[model samples]
Target: MTTGAPTPTYPARPRRSRLRTFLPLGVAAWLVLEIWLLTVVADATSGLVVFLLLLGGLVLGSVVVKRAGRRAFQALNEALQRGGTPESGGGNGLMMLGGLLIMLPGLVSDALGLILLIPPVQKTLSRYAERTVDRKLRAASAGSFGDAFQQARIHRPDGKIVPGEVVRDQPGDEPQGPVPPLTR
Candidate 1:
């Protein structure tokens, strides 16, 4: 049948991605693995062994927190004395996070928490967090930090101040007439 009107065609719906379908399966598999491993461990050693391990992990996590808390408080005090935020001193958050993870009733979290308690790993994580925060700020602020930082007198080296403004120049765009006069 021929008609002058065009045929009405509906847009195709998007298909569900493989990741969405497989993620739950992967999580289920991991949970099953953990259960099987725990069962084997329980059967091989007595339930007492599992209980001891959990108790030991809890004790260790508490010890780590007690030790780190002192250091964190010292750092926080020093930062306050120096007129800076407690967070600026670093390490406190990671240490606390590690302790929290260790406190969780899981071998995997305990292992990760132990790793995070390491000085080098804590420092690396702190730096990564700083970079991630900086990146988010930059992206959200639309390059304001970069532009302001560049022109900021406080950031100037050699103690010399220079005033400047950022001018955005886009390619393939003609200049819009002449620059307007500054108004008071």
Candidate 2:
């Protein structure tokens, strides 16, 4: 046998997605901006006012999230009883997101949250998001995770793919209003 060195083999590292690479940096920048803005507001007015504003936002966001969650649940129940997949929500999910943003401790987030609560804005955002996800899923390679997402769609009896979500109830949630009786 000839004496020769063999090349070592190693598993290739997976490429990082753009969102993964940049999200931390973006979050850091957002935190700095929010802190700076809070200080500016405190300097211009009073720290107590800022505190009150944040508290008010927290309460309002809580209310918004509760209402949206209730509505979404109701819609889901109605759809399940009808034995049909739920139509994409009428912005309740987006409203919940807005509420979450408002709950965050930042004026910028609060402003964005308030804007998202608007019906037109929510619809526009929802459409844009749908289009973007659809584009990404279509562009995904044959054997990738996106292909799994593509396969996860619910197809209608008439043979059109419809996106859907799987809902799970959290602990401590009590059923309110009339819950549909379970059938077959």
Candidate 1 residue pairs in backbone clash: none
TM-scores, one per candidate: 0.57, 0.69
Cα lDDT over the full model 2: 0.89
Tens digits of per-residue lDDT, candidate 1, 47-166, equal 888788778888888887887789888988988999987767357778887988787666777888989988899888888888999999878788666676775644344445665567
Candidate 2 lDDT, 60-79, residue by residue in tens: 99999999999999999999
Number of the top candidate by TM-score? Answer: 2
Please name the candidate that would achieve the greatest lDDT relative to the true structure: 2
lDDT of each: 0.78, 0.89
Candidate 1: residue 165 Cα off by (Å): 31
lDDT (C-alpha) at residue 120 in model 2: 92
